[model samples]
Target: MQTASRRFDLSVQYACNKEGLPSRPQFRGWARAALEGGGQVTIRLVEAEEGQELNREYRGKDYATNVLSFPYDTEPRVFGDLVICPDVVAREAAEQGKSLEAHYAHLVVHGMLHLQGWDHEEDDSAEAMEQREREILASLGYPDPYA
Candidate 1:
């Protein structure tokens, strides 16, 4: 059931509890949907500690975020690494009353979108990004993460 429109390879590394994490195929689906199978992606699932450290180091934020995107090259095609914190993701999902799977899917797509130059730092950009996210998630049979 997992496939991509073009060449897609998802390299996944887990530094957290393996349970409840999506499979490689699932990630491939998300990445493919986000980039339309444009390029390669690497996703690393991390614990809260590492997530927090990375956030602080890279983003100047001391708290752990649900996901962070690092785009390496995007001219010819989208290529990047995404770091996802399962602890944060699970907490956010539970707090928001969303399914873990759906939240993860949303984050995967969100991260991929970021890699593709999508931004939400401003109101207009955020709205556009959210709309794209809703549409993409909908395509994947997931509820709107913003809704």
Candidate 2:
């Protein structure tokens, strides 16, 4: 039998001045759809500068990308934070011909999976994660993000 998926306590923080960002409920719904167990997560919407600083400090990258997931604890519960740069998301959405909401949904799912120990570090692992992402997004009525 399948174990019950744990519920999540999610918070959305806006650290940027970007317009057209999604609301807290939207983020919560997306997170809920992706999270597989009991967890607490803070989804912080940041500007490019903060995003760049975080990437530099953590991943040794010098520029901002899209979404970053920081998982703190895992066991009976999962705790983490998801930092997302709206500027990058918007630019990527425009460039990829996808809606802003679609991109955000994809990133939220991706980050939540990371918090659950899902990774794409290897070729086979990447394929597995991508397949799972595709399934989750499709359940949420989104088209293939990789398509």
Name the candidate that leads on TM-score. 2
lDDT of each: 0.90, 0.92
After superposition, the stretches of candidate 1 with alpha carbons farther than 4 Å from their true spots are: 1-5
Question: After best superposition, candidate 2 residue 27: deviation in angstroms?
Answer: 0.5
User: Worst lDDT window (10 residues) for model 2?
Assistant: 1-10
TM-score of each: 0.93, 0.94
Write candidate 2's Cα lDDT for 1-147 as tens digits.
434347678889999885789999999989988877788899999999999999999999999989999999867778999999999999999999999999999999999999989999999999999999999999999999999
What candidate 2 gets wrong by more than 4 Å, as runs, is 1-5
Candidate 1 lDDT, tens digit per residue, 1-147?
Answer: 444435667799988899868998898888788885468789999999999999999999999999999999886677899999999999999999999999999999899999989999999999999999999999999998987
When summed lDDT is taken over every stretch of 10 residues in candidate 1, the lowest stretch is 1-10
C-alpha RMSD in Å of predicted model 2 compared with the true structure: 2.7
How many residue pairs collide in each prediction? 0, 0
